[model samples]
Target: MDAPIRKHNATDEERFWAKVDKSGDCWTWTAAKTNGYGVFRIKPRNMVAHKVSYIWAHGPVPKGYEVDHMCFNRSCVNPAHLRLLTHQENGQNRTGANTNSKSGVRGVYWAQGQWIARACIGPKTILVGRFDDLGEAERAITEWRIEHMPVSLRDRRRRVSGPLADA
Candidate 1:
């Protein structure tokens, strides 16, 4: 196996996290996004820089894998918690209200003879509103996503080519 990300002499994970300033609401880093979700910048955005720094310091990324945010936080840079996963595996692990299921992404829970919408994310669970019907549940998800995760104008998809195709 290759050396751990900490082995790199130039960039150190511990040092990277120390440079982060979270006084602002979002953890924004100066690094450009490498391999899509992987952030890399000389300065720092929020806390994501640490994660990118760790990978950059190490070596080339392995095949068929993607770095995932274990904390489910886009801004968190805690190296100890950062993990690797396949693209498909990442989708399978979706919790809360992000899953594309008819049962509801997150808020709705079936109880007794009714469907209730309880928006729970991270460590907090908000009652938001309960839905008596499935249509109500779907409506809640649509509204929630619209208000929270609005579609980005810039495309975030990454294109990766196979090895040795330049023949």
Candidate 2:
């Protein structure tokens, strides 16, 4: 679906910033939120706050690209931390392992006495490899991310810890 055309008048800009909690690097949205991301009602449509902020500062986000929050904060409307990325790239930049993950590492799971590494791109989930060691599986997933994801999307700074710390 196409994004709503924003009316960037002085009054609209004032109304937009009124809901922002500009206390830190992340200019957090204090308005209504869905799934932790801010939601703003712009007449006929309810639009995302960050998307509105991006349009206010820059322009309409390019077609086929999503606005990714580099700081990983959904409530943030800071344009400096925002970038245009494909859906796959946006998913690759996701923070933390899934809540249901038993392995503690993202894309690594234990099954049938082996650690299986997998990577998801768009709708397709590709099996990277299977290994007896969790470290090997983690490494395989990391390699896949490095190859398929952009440098900005890769979660390289987060050191793997917990049960898989050594791994």
Candidate 3:
């Protein structure tokens, strides 16, 4: 079944910002930029948080923790929906073009009895390693991403399809 539709609008971003309290404590402050990019806590990267939970649930500047926007909209600041996650757990929810570009284990082919890991780095797809199990392939890519991509930028790429794209 399809998920229920949440409220959405392209109205002025200023409308949301007015509801935040910029001078309050970290847990209670209005954590958003004036531009309505969503509530952002000032820091190295302007961490995005939901206004209700007063929790920033995305990007890596917070360090050692993972934030995920349950609403799925980067510009959405509904605190009730934000969730904290581990770096690994956050990676599991990723969906986008970068993840879809025939990369990682998604495009690999194994011989009848073999297990292999592969990904597209740019224009070419290459082998990551040969493993005995799918779990091992997952570990390889996880390690590769941790080593090569920045914490804040991990799985940051996103792709939207279907009716939503028409907007």
Candidate 4:
């Protein structure tokens, strides 16, 4: 998971760099994109541009580890904004709350007419507490998240008092 990174090859790097538009902070890929991620066709297969960028900056990606964009930008190829994470670790940065959640917060839910604050780390659900007020529930979950979740996995643009993100 902590493997070092280095550019794979010069020819591949040259071809990959040609398609990227480094206009601003988040270097964007100007070529074919599948689901907003850049795709490059090599002899063997296609590689995601951000993954290529990660490889160019770091090294080969470890198995089962995903390249996550901390800035919430799918087209960004900036290596500094990218990180390698497990599926569960990456899930913590999700913008949308659960679809069935009434409180519209990641770990806060409404059940039996009361607000419930809870969070899941790995396979276990940690029940923060129950609250009558929604704000209190949000605060409880926020506190739990701040105390428990790793700092790099936390969502910076989390909904404070609005609908669950762009679900």
Poorest 10 consecutive residues by lDDT, candidate 1: 152-161
lDDT of 3 by residue, 108-167 (tens): 445656566665543566677887776566556545554544332333331133222232
Report the lDDT of model 1 for residue 38.
35
Which regions of candidate 1 are displaced past 4 Å? 1-39, 42-51, 56-59, 98-103, 106-167
Question: What TM-score, to 2 decimals, does candidate 4 have?
Answer: 0.78
Q: Kindly report which residue stretches of model 4 are placed more than 4 angstroms away from their true locations once superposed.
A: 1-10, 151-167
For each candidate in the order shown, give its overall lDDT on alpha carbons.
0.50, 0.81, 0.48, 0.80
Q: Write the per-residue lDDT of candidate 2 for residues 83-158, one digit (tens) a residue.
A: 8888767778877579999988889999999999988877899999999988778877876786777543445554
Q: Residue pairs in steric clash, candidate 2?
A: none
Q: Candidates ranked by TM-score, best first?
A: 2, 4, 1, 3
Estimate the overall C-alpha local distance difference test score of candidate 1: 0.50
- Estimate the TM-score for candidate 1: 0.37
In the predicted model 3, the residue pairs found to clash are 21-30, 31-39, 31-40, 32-39, 32-40, 57-67, 57-68, 96-159, 104-119
- Give lDDT for model 4: 0.80
Q: Pick by TM-score: which candidate is best? A: 2
lDDT of 4 by residue, 84-105 (tens): 9988888766765788877787
Q: Worst lDDT window (10 residues) for model 4?
A: 158-167
